[model samples]
Target: MRIALLSYSTKPRGGVVHTLALAEALAAAGQDVTVWTLGRGGDAGFFRPVDPAVRLRIVPFPDGPAGESVGERILRSIATLREHFDGTGYDIVHAQDCISANAVDSCVRTVHHIDHFTTPELAACHERALTTPYAHVCVSATVADELAAGWGLKAEVIPNGVAYERFADTDPAARDRWRRRLGRYVLTVGGIEPRKGSLDLLEAYALLRERLPGLQLVIAGGETLFDYRDYRTRWETRAAELRVRPLVLGEVPDDDLPALVAAAGAFAFPSVREGFGLAAMEALAAGVPLTVRDLPVLREVFGPAARYAATPEALAAELAAALTGDDPTRRTAGRTLAARHTWAEAARRHLAFYRCLG
Candidate 1:
């Protein structure tokens, strides 16, 4: 099959990561797969090196004019990709996010997680992205259910595959390097955004600090298109008032990320809304103790492989346990579960889905 996978950016955002991995897996399965993405801010390549077997088409997207509204940027981004993307000759043109989904009609879409939008243009775009596609895919049953309930869309559930060996097989020497640098830290990826539950994590970290004075809060991998200055300002102010400092490593080197995850004393995933807890799953693959927010989606994804907390206070308590407690059984369970998900399997399922669409 000649397949084209579209994503909004060349960054390491979740959907982009999904697009690249799925394409490579498909290519390995003897499918002709090409990954397409908008190169925001003059980027020429992806955050990490992609498999050489999968073809890459990076569309150059220059920054919008000064004071350009997000709505305008959204419109421009869709127009730019649509104008350049030649989806012809592809058996399956799968869009991985709203921008790419809205860029073309008569395409299949992967609805990672549907969002609620307030801006008129954004709401309209979201609507089209949701309803325009002929068929849909989701990363989790929880997200598929939301599509069915909200829009009567029957999206096929294809769970995300982790880089199991990359994370699980992290070299002890590499892990020791990060441990030497950060010194017993609790880590979270995905930036300081509302959906990430950043404020909640901040509050929880503050409470945890009273007991674990030596433990640090380290954050990495924050690449997004949205403007979160207000939320970030608020987070910083609170962090100052609480007298807790978090090391915000904006984007860790791709080679170093697995080791960074492996070195952490515990991983905190306090996201309020998630299609699937891919980051937490990576932590599990690394055998790191985990504490996640008590969200239905996360519960469905992680099952009993992780600890959950509903409130900041509860989160603080759970995080403390993760730092100080010993649970070899849970560690073994997490690694086993992570091992069960493989991109090759996911690619075969995707092939079946595309064949079914015929």
Candidate 2:
């Protein structure tokens, strides 16, 4: 089968990561796979090297005019991708995000999670993406249920696959390097965005710091097309009020990410909304203690592998336990859980779905 997987950006966001991994896995299964994405900010390729078997079509999307609203950017993104993408020969045209789903004439969309957009263009685009697709997929049953309840659309639930070995097999020397540089730290990925519950994490870290004075808060990996300046400004003001200074590493090298995850004393995932907590799963694979927001999707995905918390106070308590307690059974369960989600299995299931569409 000739499959074309479409994504909105070349950055290392979770959806883009899923697109690349699934494409590679499909190619490995002897299917012809081509990935289509817009090269935002003049990017020529993906954040990491892709497997040679999978073909790439990177459409150049130069920066928009200064002072462009996010809604304007969304419209331009769809037009630009629509202008460049030719899904002529693919047996399965799968779109991974709103932009690509809106850009294409018809496709099978993977609704990683549902979002409520206020921007008129963005809201319209989001609605069209959800309503227009011939078939839909979700990374968790919780999200699939959302599609069913809100839109009355039934979607196939296929969980994401973590690069289990990449993290689990990280060298001890590499882990030690991060520890030497940062000391004992609690880490979270996905930047200081509202959805990530960045402000909540800040509050929790402040509370935790009172007891664990030596522990640090580290944040990494925030790449997105939307403007979060207003939310970020609010976060900064709140951080100042809380008197906590988190080491904000915007984006780390992909090669060093596993070691960084492995070195953390505790991994924090306080996201208010998520399709799947890929980064948290990576932490599990790295044998790091995990704590996440008390969301149904996360509960379904992490099960006994992670600690759950609902508020800043609860998050702080969970993080403290994750750092101080030695629950070897839970740790073992985490590693086994992460190892069970393989890209090969995800790919096989995706192929079966595509066949059913025929």
Worst ten in a row by lDDT for model 1: 11-20
lDDT of 1: 0.92
The C-alpha stretches of model 2 lying farther than 4 A from their native spots are none
- Model 1 stretches astray by more than 4 angstroms: none
The ten-residue window of minimal lDDT in model 2 covers 236-245
| All candidates: CA RMSD (Å) | 0.7, 0.6
Question: What does candidate 1's lDDT look like per residue over 252-305, in tens digits?
Answer: 888999999999999999998899978889999999999999989989988888
- TM-score, candidate number 2: 0.99
Model 2, position 266: C-alpha lDDT score: 94
